[model samples]
Target: PVPVLLNYIYSPSTSMFVSLLSVDLPKPTLTVEPESSVFSGESVTLKCEIKGYDGWTYQWYKQDKQSRWSAVSQSEYYTVNRDTLTIRADAVIHGDQYRCSGERHDRLTSSQYSDFVTLTINALPTATLTVEPEGPVFTGGSVTLKCEIQSHSNWRYQWYKGSSRTAVSQSETNTFTIRSAADQDQYWCRGERDDRPSSSQPSNTVTLTVKGEAKAVLSIKPDKHVFRGEAVTLRCDIQWGRDTECKYSWYKEANTLYSSSTTQEFRFSPAEESHSGNYTCSGEDIGNSGYSQSSDAVTLTVTEGPVFSGESVTLKCEIQSHSNWRYQWYKGSRRTAVSQSQTNTFTIRSAADQDQDQYWCRGERDYRPTSSQPSNTVTLTVKGKISNFPLPQMSTYLMFGTPKVLYLIENNAKT
Candidate 1:
């Protein structure tokens, strides 16, 4: 027994070195994003990678069950071309369980699984909104306002006046009737999704203003100082009435002188003696009695008188009392160019010794006349002709036949 123990103890102390190589496990990375919680129908991509392993083979595995695993059937689906492995996740396949395993030489390394990702799919709802007017909108006219949402499953409407929010519609129906015109108020509409509102852009505003009735008034400019044989006009202006089918009428002494069934100026050209009277005007109202009051009467005066200058003028008018009388002019009791009208200026064209005869202006008319009165007398004298002077004593001497003394007197007379 001593010999057997000695032999065992005599064996040399041999050392054995052992090293453990660390091959990193393949880690599954998410290259693609999952569907967002807010939006739906999205796409996702996943990739797997492993470090510390060169020239290593890879395999992809999906973990649907908590503890079980399944190989991805399609090699392209797993996409393990290199150390990095990628895969896609659609809307239907949202939940997790993805991993990658690596192998170096003949030894298999452990695997890394990806974190859980979720997916959701949603369908956008059909939505639209519109407005309707009950009737044609005119300026100052009443109208009905209607808001219509055609088919909005989960949407709301907002009504606005200018930049201010007026009303909101939770349900489908949104309408408002306005008895007044759009000029009274401005309106527009907007839409929103769910309870929270989106960016709102209002519709274009509609404006309305309607016209009512027409009105008119009369404006007249009358003459302050009117003269005979002078023309005048009565102007009719439609200040508030309709321009179409407007009429006018002018009257003198309560008698209509002119009536126009349209808008016109009634003009009197070269006014006469009878026209020297009261005048007024009135406006007709739609086949009814006149509405506006008559204008103040304008008076016209007829003046007749003679203006002249003469000597010894006994203006003989063959008649009686003179009242409202007109006058005429005469030369040598013969009528002149003057009428029964007033002359502003009168002058004799030729002044001769014959003009020294009696000349005067007399007043006359159809009713009566005035007696001619003598003006200052004028004496006519012949110049440079003493022989033309008549002498009674000389005429008796000349009548007797010529004696020697008569011949001497004749020679003296000739001298």
Candidate 2:
């Protein structure tokens, strides 16, 4: 154990045996004060700058993000102030690298090492929350809540609703409109900035369900005066809660008589009057709240009955999906065609009382509804013939044991 000569320093132009012993040294320049482009709750400030020199003693250096080169220790995102280092969390320094050096107030030493500064933590923008015409949202309308932030512009918006820290609305333009919305809601969004991690990271919970504006009722079942061939079913009632789904549209005087349908029936087996008119129905309930307020019309009238002229009447003309039909027969108008048959029955025969009136029929088939909407008007009525009454005097008598029959009537003179 014989060695006593420590703190050794000998560096004469790179002969090397140095702990640190200066004579000519000044290179410190580290700099980075609001300049390294930061964001996660930012607070940067680095400055070393040696230039003319002033009684030094500072020290800090790092390379990190795994390129490894340590010595800037103060932990938890740094704060070593002598020449100033203070980074305090830009989400813990991304891609980290920094430098600084000093040690001269006559401790004889070093200054050089500074150039390395590199940090860019800009990842705190995301705030999503979308629904500007994209949801079932409907309780009186008006819903536009898009706060989608990703970083391309200034950003200043905050809106929250469900867990409520209280913000419901605040905008520079990310959008937030609510007017009359009711029934269900949840929303979220946050993004604001003057600089640094000023806020962001609260989006992803947009519910906004709100539905209760549906009311379509059009129901025609078995009544509304129908009888051409009988069989009509048109139901479109609307509910809106327990699995209430819809997408049907069928109208008739307001136009569009369509029904490729999505359930809720609309049948018509032989229903005439050209399917009668004034009917209404609508209910598109899936999202974005569009069709549902249109249903009280219902005036379908098909009717036809009254036949007694000697009783033979039979005008039928059917085309239930086609088979050869070609029967016309109209008598009131249709330019009065009266008979062009393939025999779908048009018999009148035993009438003779001037045959009565109003009849109708149609069926011509080149296929697709080629002419078949007239039917349902049969009215015929004619009655005459019945007269002859004259019976007065007659007398006959026969008698035998207990049998006697007689009838006599004759009036003359007094009594």
Candidate 3:
């Protein structure tokens, strides 16, 4: 091909020769609407435009953080127009780059690629609210509501009660404390960053139900009237619910007999008069709230029976508020009708060695043969018999008779 010189003359005040050369190609410019910064599940539009150009085909490319680039295709996460790309879904990966370029009908004529624009997807932090001391709580108890964010720090907390959109509490901390919890108090919580106005979705609602205070009851194992030197057990029972791990306390009259005991049964071996008094019990919950209301008072009476030997001892059957009672005594498993009087008293006059045996007493009404519950068994100890010795015969007045009679015989012998 011979190079032919081609020139054109244009007059602009003077005639100048211009050579025919290659034409200049236009470069496309890409701009994203609403900026490249957006939250997840939001839509963004990418537009590629070339000035002074028409009938151009547009192509979009995407690059990830791993330095990999691929041509974008129409899918659930994205859609393509002639010169604009729409991100339809909020599933865009973070730190992704997007760009577009235009091509004309002539393959040789193409526009330079636009500057890369990074797509930053800000993921909303997750929040969860939990209650302390799970399960039903008692009224007037302390409880805490804690909000947790998924691996995020420096987040302010927002607390909501029931379905109300208004926040009950807002603070940099993630916990909400209820010093005295009330019934039917429902709560929810969320988290937000101080720098961002948007907040995470509200957490699941938690409904709090409060229970009434528990009552303690005191029970005695054997009869309330026990004999001295008998084993007795005082049990404290809770009627509200069953909790074996609850702490219990026992009180005798105005004094605290036992405190902070795991066992509900208070044992008294060989019960004495001192153990007989007004007894009450109380219980505490798992949170160690103040002790429950004191139980009804139970009166215990301990009576002494034939405890010594060779002594007059009275065996009384002590009954609670009853008159005109007859007393029946038992000696070594042998029942003996002792008396029928206003007072139930059985006296053992001059108690001998044979009286050393187990004795018990019961109260009976003169009108009926029925007897009350048997009293505790008491063993009586009697002293052994003592022996007597006769006095020895002695010679007397021998010294006085010796002076008068001059001859007197005195005999000292055991007869």
Report the number of the highest-TM-score candidate.
3
Q: Write one digit per residue (lDDT tens) for candidate 3, span 1-415.
A: 2345566667676767665544456668888765735766567888999888788998889986678777897888777888889987465666678888888886767777888888777766678899876766666656788998875467889999887889989988888887776656789998877544256767878887677666789999797988666789999987534333578899998689999998889999787755778999988764625246679999987654333333455554555534565656677866664344555556666667776777656666655434466665655555543234332321111111111111111121211
TM-score, prediction 3: 0.51
Candidate lDDT scores, in order, read 0.41, 0.67, 0.68
Ranking by lDDT: 3, 2, 1
Q: How many clashing residue pairs appear in each of the predictions shown?
A: 11, 1, 1
TM-score of each: 0.24, 0.37, 0.51
CA deviation > 4 Å runs, candidate 1:
1-31, 34-39, 65-67, 75-92, 110-415
- Give residue 140's lDDT in candidate 2 (0 to 100): 64
Clashes in model 2: which pairs? Answer: 41-197
Per-residue error at 95 for model 2, in Å?
8.9
lDDT (tens digit, per residue) of candidate 2 on 1-415: 2234447677999998867433456678778888746776677888887877688877887876678777876778777766787877643567777777888867667877878877777777788888766657557656778888776567789898888888877878888887657758687889887755677878898788877676789889888877556789988887654343468888889898885378887888777646767889888755434456778899987644333334445555554554666777777655667778776766665554666667656667686656655555554544543234332221111111111111111111111
Regions of model 3 farther than 4 Å from truth = 1-37, 40-123, 196-198, 222-225, 237-247, 253-263, 286-291, 296-415
RMSD of each: 27.3, 20.7, 17.3
Clash count, candidate 2: 1
